[model samples]
Target: MAKVGRGLPAPKSKRRVKYGPNVVRLVCEDLASGMTYNEVTQGRGRPSHSSLYEWRRRYPEFAEATDAARAFGAEVCGDRALEVAEQATEETVRKAKLEVDTLVHRAAVLAPERWGGRGAGLRRAEPIEVVFSVRRFEKVVGPDGRVCVREIKPEGEV
Candidate 1:
């Protein structure tokens, strides 16, 4: 009988991403069209976000194009969020609102200057309902290395 040997994992193979002309165009367009790095990677057969960043670092043109696209993408996300908020129906209100919030956050992250920064939240073309929640908590981390949680008192006391 052959005995198997316990050994370290094999070295990772070098994955060569094909940065063809279309690759550059598509990546640039995705960014320019308001798609985040995560979104770009979500597409079928797309490269990882890290790879996209690495490519940008290696290629000056890619970096320039991506930088230009960031603001455009932020604006697009902001616009789409507003549209979703407006078109949301009673049945899909919760889902649509969540989507709006996500887009707003992404837009803000992409271009805080244009979106009025973190504290300002998102810009809306028209008045739309926004829902937010607040919670209070008390952190109790003992020597046991486990977190002990307690409800925070209303009077600013834990």
Candidate 2:
């Protein structure tokens, strides 16, 4: 029988240890510093890429940080979109108001008794219907105390 000598009673099986914040921070910093996943794993010696990926997935702090960064990016994009929308709305409202004012002024000048003089009750003009195929007009109150569009019927047309 061949004599098989046990080598130093075989080293005790080490318990699997969860890495602490410091280790995770070090790995994250290394990654941020342009170290690849393979390089980080090789340098840390304690964790493999798969294990590190799992830890990052399981860790709440890491997940929260990632989510926060993503939210910030989204917020920036949303703010830009909001700014553009606000500007366009302002311009549209300004243009609409100007058009309404010009039309009112012309009506007042042409038919002072119908539109400008005292006791000049509500008078309907020709029903001017504008069709917008691409854009729809949103009914909005203007600074002037009147509706933007007042439907007017043609003279003597019931």
Candidate 3:
């Protein structure tokens, strides 16, 4: 029978799981290996998201490791998707395609601005066409040295 919180349960500080140093390192490695949170927890003493978040906040090294791992994981996903797509078997072609597509989508979501869907700066907007007609305006100067001129903005703004 474990006591609650050591002092009537402080609450947020309550640790859901106790993760050891080696396990933490393994967790980081697993993450870097492109394992999802669920996969990481599969056999390595399943820690909740809150526990992971708390660990990251408490340990700067963990935070950095997690960030790097996630980035690497995203890369792994992209690479695996490409590989799977290229070498899909006939029998599993459909399944492989779906898996690859999912991986690609996941990679995009993980790093949206860099490898995301639709691209970083893509947006939905009405299609527009611009027509340009070049016209030469000869300068006309009066005896008083007054010249006729008009300023042109990029979009024909005056």
The TM-scores, one per candidate, come to 0.54, 0.30, 0.54
Tens-place lDDT digits, model 1, residues 24-64: 88877888798768777764556777788788899898888
lDDT scores in order: 0.80, 0.54, 0.77
RMSD of candidate 1 to the truth, in angstroms, is 17.2
Name the candidate that leads on TM-score.
3
Could you arrange the candidates by lDDT from highest to lowest?
1, 3, 2
Model 3 lDDT per residue over 62-117, tens place: 88888777878889999999899889889999999899989988877666656776
Off by over 4 Å in 1: 1-15, 42-46, 90-92, 118-158
With a 3 Å backbone cut-off (N, CA, C), the pairs that clash in candidate 3 are none
Which of candidates 1 and 3 reaches a greater TM-score?
3
Candidate order by decreasing TM-score: 3, 1, 2
Candidate 3's C-alpha runs over 4 A off are 1-21, 44-46, 89-91, 117-158
**lDDT value for model 1:** 0.80
